[model samples]
Target: MLDQAFLLYGANGYTGELIARYAAAYGLQPILAGRNKQALEQLGAELKLPVRVFALDDKIAMQQALQEVPVVVNAAGPYDFTAKQLVEACIAEGRHYLDLNGDAIIYDMIHTYDKAAKDSGVMLLPGAGYDVVPTDCLALWLKQQMPDARSLKIAFAVLNSSLSRGTAINTVLKLGLPGLSRIDGKLVEEPVGKRGMYVQFPGMKKKLFTMSLPWGDLSTAYVSTGIPNIETYINMNKAAWFFLKGQGAYNWLLKTKLVRGIANAIVKRQSPGPDKATRDKTNTLIWAQVSNENGNTLTANMVVPEAYTLTALAALLITRKVLNKEFTPGYQTPATAYGTELIMEIPGVQRGLVQ
Candidate 1:
C-alpha cells in the first residue's frame, strides 16, 4: 500500500487531471477514480498510479475505493449535486472528505453533517481549492487583526484566466439566482451586482472595478470568524459591471432551459480551460476588509497563482496535512481548520495589509 495516497474522484475532469499530474510534486500518489472507465485508465497509465472505476451511485464500489485510501479529494463540480453523496460515503467509511466546491448552498448543506463527521473521525472540509482558501484565510487574518469586527467583505479577480467546462456550466445554471450575503448573522438574498466599487489592490497600478457577488464565504466566513455581516465581490470591467447591474431585465431568459443549453454547448465546444501557457502567466487578486462597530476598518490584499493552479496546490496541501495526521474532524473551512497562514503555503502567494 502506498503510504501517502488518496482517492481522487473526477480525475477525468480538467482540475482533477491537474491535481493527479501534480500529486508527485507533493510527495504523494492519487488513486484516480471516476465513472469514465476509459478516461480513468488513460490518466492512471500516464500518472502510473492505481485507478479505481466507480460512480458515486455505486455504494459497494465507492466503499471499496474509500477503503483503498484514507482521504478523498472530489474535483467534481456542481457540488450541490455531488458533495452530499460523497460526504455521506466518507462519513460512513471514516474517510476525510475534501472538495474544490465554492458554492454557498453546498457549504450550508455539508455543515449539517458536522456531528456525524466528528463522530466518525472524518473531516468534512469543502472549498479546499481556490474557492475559499485564499478568502477564508484572509477572513481569519482580518479577524485576528480586529477581534471586534462587525462586518467583513471579500473580493477576488482572476487577472487572466478562463473557466473549465464544468465551471462554465455551473455558472450557466446560476444565471438567474440571486446574490447572497450574511447580514446581522442571517443569510439574505440580494440582487446580483447590486453594489459596485473601485479597489486599489496591492501590486496593481490602477483600481479594479468590483461588483457584489454571492461567493461561498457568505456561508464559510461567518462560521470561520463569527462576523455578523459579510458580503463578497468579484472584479469586473465597466461594461461587464453595467451589464450585470441590468441582469434583472433578462434574467428570465437566462434561466430558460433553451438559453442554458445553448450556453453549455458553447462552453463544451471551447477549450477545456486556459491553456498551459495562459495558466502559467495568470494570477489572481484577492482583497478583503473587516470593520468594527465604530467604522474602523483594516484592509488586506493577496495575490496567488491562477485559479486552477492554486486549486490543485491548495487541495493537495490540505490532503497532505490529513495524510500527516493534521486535521480537525467535522465541517471546516480551510483557514478555520488550518489557520490564517495556510494560504501562504501555496507557491507564489503574497499577502499583506494595505497601508
Candidate 2:
C-alpha cells in the first residue's frame, strides 16, 4: 500500500502555508514539514495538521522522515537549489514526488532523471502548479478540439496575486539569462521582449507582452503531447515588466556580499504578501490558440483559481493519482498524466473554445 503522503518542504513559507490550508480543507491532513520546527508547528497549528520537521541538507533526517510517506508535495522555491537532494532521497526511498517548480532550468535537469524514475517505478512530476497546470491542460484541450492540430501558441495573463519573495529572489538570480524554447523541433534562444504580442482572451481582448522568464511547462508539455511547434508566453502589467527589466542591477548586487545582505534584509521585511481580502479578490485569465496543417484553428480560455490555492489543488491531484496507481513512473507534466478532461473537472475552472 502507498504510505501517507506528506507536504515535505516549505511548510512554513507563505505559499506553503496556503497549500497546507487547502490540504486541510480536503481532509488530507498532510504532514507539515520544514527545517524550522517552530514555524512548521505554527503553520500546522493554524491548519490543525500534524507537523514533522526535517532539513533538506540532512540526508539522514530526510530519509527518516520519508519512512511512512510514499509521496511528497514539495512547495519549496528556487527549486534549482532545492530539488536535487530531495529527488535523490525520493529515488532511494522509492517514493513518488511532486513539486510546484516553475524554473525551466530545474525542470530540464529533472527531465534527465526520467529513465531513473521509470526504472525505479517512482513518478516525478514538476511544475504541478498554476505556473503550468492550467495552460498545459488548455493545450491538450485545444488539440482535442482540432484533431489535426500541428502547432500551438499559449498566452497567459494574471491580473492578481502579488509575486512572492521566493519568486522575486529566483527571478533576480536568473537575470540576464537567455530564454529558450523548443520551436519546430529545435531549441532556440529568443531575444527578450522581441516576441511580445496581443492575445484575444475570453471576456477581454488585450495586448500582452511576452515574459522573458522561461517556464518549465513548455518542456514537459511538448514531451507529453508531441506537439512539434509550441510556445508559452506570460503577460504582466507595465510596472511589473519595467521592474523585471531593471533586474540587471539586482543581479549585480547579488555578487557583492554586503549588497546581497541588504537585498535579503529588504526582501525579508517585505515578504509577507497581500492580505486575505486582497487574495480572495485575485483572479487569472489564460488564452490558448492551436493551428493545424489543415488551416483549422481552435482557441480556449481558462479561468484559474488563486495562485496559491491552485498550487495545493494541483499537488493534491498528483498525490491522489500516485496513491491510486493512475500515473506512469516517470517525469511528466500534470496534463500529460491526468489529461484535459480530468483537469477541467476541478471546480471554478472555466473552459471555452473558438473555431
Candidate 3:
C-alpha cells in the first residue's frame, strides 16, 4: 500500500510554491518534486519538505518519485505536456491525482482513462483549482435548483496585477487554439473568438466583454449536471480581444516550435508571479446563469480571493478530504466528489442566486 503522504509535484513553480506554503501550514508534509534541483532545494529549505527531482519524460524515475505519496497535487501548467504523464504514472502507482490545470485537452484525456483509474483503484481529480472548482460547484448547484435547465452560461472575471510565468506561457500557447462549447450534449469546436459579448455582473455598472474559451467546466459540468448546452467566457477588454482575435491569423507562425520556444524563453526571464502583497489584494468573481427550455432561469454569483490564493486553499482542503478517506475513485470533479456547496467552504467565497 502507498504511504499516506501528498506529493507536491512542480513545487518550484510559483503556483506550486503557493500550494506548498499552505500545505505546510495545514501540517501536510508534502514531498516537493520538480525538474529544477536548485529551485526545489530552495523551496524545500523554506518549507522543510523533502524534494524529488525528475524530468517529466522519465517514466521510471517519475513512478519511483511517486511511490511514497498516495496523493499528487500537481500545480504545473501548460499541462498539455504534463497532465497525461502524471495521470498515467499515478494510475500505475495507485496514487490519486489532482491538479489546478484548466486546459480542455487534459479533460478530454481524462475521459479516456477514467476506466483505467477506476480499475487501479485510484482517483483522477483534475481542475481542483480556480479553473473549474468553483464554477463546477455552481453549475451543479444551479442544476439542483432548476433540474429542468437545458442551457448554461458561465463567465469569469479575474482581477490580478500580473500573470505568473506559467500562466503567461499557458496564455501564449492557448491563444491561437480554437474555442469550444457543449451543444446538445456534444463537444463542439468553434472559431477562436466566437460568441464574444459584453456580460454584466450583479453589482457592476460596467459590463465586461468575454470571448468564448474551452474552460474545464465545458467538460466537467456535463458530468456533474447533465446540462446539454454549455458555454464559457473569460472577461476581456476590447484591447485584449483585439489581440486574442488576431491569434488565429498568425497561428500558423505561433504554432511553430521555433516561435513557441522563443516565447517560452522570453517568459523564463520574467517574474514568476505577483508578490505576496499583490496576491493579498487580488480577487476573482464568477457569474453563472442557467435556463430551462420553458424560459425559467436561475443566476448565481461567486466571489473569492486571488485565483492563485484560491487554488492553494482549494487544493489543501481537497487533499485533506482525500487523506481522511472522504474520497471517490475514477475521474472526479470537486463538485461531483464533494458537493455543490464545496466552494462555500473557502474563506472569502460567497454565492447567492439573482432574484
Q: Candidate 2 on 127-242: residue-level lDDT in tens? A: 88887788778787777767677787777776756777877676656545666766786556764443556676666755566554457655766766677777777785656666
lDDT of 3 by residue, 160-245 (tens): 66788999999778645677899999888887667788877655788877888778888899889999999998888778777766
Model 3, CA-based lDDT? 0.86
- What ranges in model 2 sit over 4 Å off? 1-4, 205-212, 237-264, 293-296
Which candidate tops lDDT? Answer: 1
Candidate 1 regions with alpha-carbon error over 4 angstroms? none
TM-score of 2: 0.88
Global Cα RMSD, each model:
1.1, 2.9, 1.9
RMSD of 3: 1.9
Positional deviation of residue 102's Cα in model 1 after best superposition, in angstroms: 0.6
Error of 2 at 328 (Å): 1.8
What C-alpha lDDT values do all the predictions have?
Answer: 0.91, 0.73, 0.86
Which residue pairs come into collision in candidate 1?
Answer: none
Candidate 1: 10-residue stretch with minimal lDDT: 76-85
